[model samples]
Target: MGNGHGLVTLLLGAILMGASSFVQGNSSKHVVCYQGTWSVYRPGLGKFGVEDIDPFLCTHLIYAFLGIEETGQLRVIDAYLDLEDNSGRGNIKSFNALKLKNPVLKTLVAVGGWNEGSKKFSVVARDPLKRAKFVDDVVRFLQRHGFDGLDLDWEYPNQRHSLENEDRSNYITFLKELKEGLEPFSFMLSAAVGSAQFSAELSYDIPAIVPYLDLINVMAYDLHGPWDEVVGINAPLYAAAGDASDSTGRMQQLNVDAIVKYWLLAGAPPEKLVVGVPFYGRTFTLTTPDGNQPGSPHIGKGIAGKYSREPGVLGYNELCELMQQEEWTQKWESAQQVPYAFRQRQWVGYEDTRSLSLKAQYVMDHHLGGIMIWSLESDDFRGTCGQQRYPLLHEINRVLFGANTPTGLTQESSDDKPSEGFRCPAGAPEGYVRDPDDCTKFYYCSGGNTHSFNCPVGLNFDLSTKSCDYSSSVKC
Candidate 1:
């Protein structure tokens, strides 16, 4: 979803995100990891599986994209890989089993990503019986599979893929009904939303639906890439002055700052907002080596990563391997608080550990809920960069949580865990307020007095539900 454009490679499937690594945080912030299930097929180093994942790196892990048919019934995108029935691999159970490693983790199944399109969802939402049946079927599927919730990666409602605009209202009805149905099971609901102002405006009535979601994960990357005329920051923190002069004329608002601001202005509460970050780079082949700046013209397709082998994209690990060599020169774009590198003809823009740290602070500064990663396997899980594995994610967690976050990504020890001591706020309302430093702790208020408490070991505080619940079942 981050690569909203029709990049030949990123357009392949349900725009997905994932998490893996050994580090766990009591972070009150959300670490949503989306995994592209097909990465398991990546020839060698790129091949990843649920067992390769670390349960603690993310608070919630999403299995992207189960499919939905025209009739509103759900289907597995890859039964041979996802189910165990009929001698299948049973990835559904393997993905959910990450919770056994970190019981507080939330596992969710996503339906209808970019490739899945909007027609089937629109058709279902428009029909009362179909919508109800779909919701019922989804809940049963989740229960049978032991998932904590469902993520709607519907791409959009009322988008061009759909024939009618009634999708906007119908989506609200669907959410309302889905909420009522899931409430009995305490299953949290989330949606992967587009970040562009034009698409978001067309796709959702943000205010009307915010009340129904636990987290609103904005696919905030892909602001610029090979789809555009120049070498632009893939997820620029701020639009540069020269960007406005671009041929497409989208430069002014095609940035992370503007996208998040638009969502806030559109009535999405700060706490429910989880900004998306890419662990990969938008790569392109430069038309001229000398013109290597952000606006440099490009040939529109860069060399594929040795691992991902996707023409227009490179995983962070692939980019890092290139940067490790003396020939590749990396530069920092201070104007955008981002990083990009050029190795002769190939120019790529992507987020690094430093940029992600800045983004972590950005999330807290804006009082936004947390950060969402595009996929689990793209990060340097193999430690090929000669650093600890999953450095980008670990950096974000350290900054978002506290200075003393666990350093071990593979093993947990009682020694590194710190205790929270957040003071109760004065003149607070009579309810529960989760600790900003600890996902497991909450401060309860009654008659202007407060007492701090912790969620059961396997759960986290759900601000939306006003109680402690499973990570997948709670809204941050």
Candidate 2:
């Protein structure tokens, strides 16, 4: 329903931190950030490159999902991007290059994602020779690419994708082999495990694998989404009253509290359990106009966003942009501790600064290792929604490390900075200025510099608060 992210983060595991602090691997707490490299393909505001990352925010940066061959070899999903060309633009090198700016950051590459599926991985895991080659390939691939570790993002091992984990016991056995191969290089080994009990029981012998894993990233979000017949929050902190206890405890198991408890009781140590915090929201097209609340029926996924261009999900940047509109009404659900907004039939349940900060506090209270953001790319890196660029991430950072700052948080990248490439015109000294070259763009001049922006499609650039409008509404 979403871009690969709909199930991807859940597939890899989940969201936040704004303002970079030196949250290193050995630090008292963990802040794991997964970068969906696919974001590079997104145009305009949605484009997020490694250079866009705030190096100081996370201790661990996992470059999401390198592909795996059926015969048990690592494959670069985008060799054109990951590998260095004659032109020397390699995403892998640039991704790992962030460590130069932040020496404390531990960069890792993940293999397997929702799209990669389980069949290839499951088959490889069951074959000893194939598994050994896979382990060796992972080690060599990481070392060659200069990654500090490998994140085993198998989605769920035993779930019948109809491919992965058919043998059931192959996952633990595969991990044993992977551990041996990785240990020699001192590479950190982590896994993105399922959250709810149903998947947990089906996928893991957690105790057996915990011994080999340095971090067990709980894919704690995505408990419910468009797939469900009824509406639900993307990542509810606590079970809502409406989430009445069912005979199977499906509702109870869907929240963060229950998911964490299940993992702890199942034998994961508090330090090893890194909780997932989702950065994006799941959207739905309500079956009825008034059916905006959670548990309501839906016709299908909500309309795709202006950016991200995915039907069933909206990136935080897209969500915030919608919130700026007059028709969209955002409301908080006290029970779930997350927010949902709707304009007509479109509804989405998503996280905010308050929810993320509370989740950080929850991690501390529960004695969990740290909070892992589903991604760094989805946050409002453009600072389009006011506040700092990554308001949600910043709230968690401020709460977790007391990283206090006013005005600009740090020397942010001008790659997507507001009015980055434009300049103030002589006639218009400040405020919104028309682009000299193109009518489809404008600049917001402030603080003696031009803060430029592109006018939304089919709209003429104008000097108004609305930013852009149809040709008939205003004079260009």
The positional error of residue 420 in candidate 2, measured at the CA in angstroms, is 26
Judged by whole-model lDDT over C-alpha atoms, candidate 1 comes out at: 0.77
User: On residues 444-468, what C-alpha lDDT tens digit does candidate 1 reach at each position?
Assistant: 4434544444554566666765555
Candidate 2 runs further than 4 Å off? 1-26, 86-88, 163-167, 404-476
Deviation in Å, model 2, residue 342 alpha carbon: 0.8
Clashing pairs in 2: 15-277, 15-373, 15-374, 17-393, 18-393, 18-394, 118-164, 119-163, 419-451, 419-452
Model 2, global lDDT: 0.75
lDDT of 2 by residue, 1-476 (tens): 11221122112111111112222122357788999998888988889998788876777899987989989988888888788866646898888766444334677899998888888888898889999889889877876777878999987687857765354588888888898888876778998888998888888888888998999999888887889998888999999897775776688889999899999999999999999988899999999989888888997788676767889888888888877864787889899888888888889999988888889889978878988888888899889888788887778766666652111123332112444356665565324456766766554443354443444335565455333455666576
lDDT per model vs. reference: 0.77, 0.75
Worst 10 residues of 2 by lDDT: 10-19
Q: How well does candidate 2 match the true structure in TM-score terms?
A: 0.79
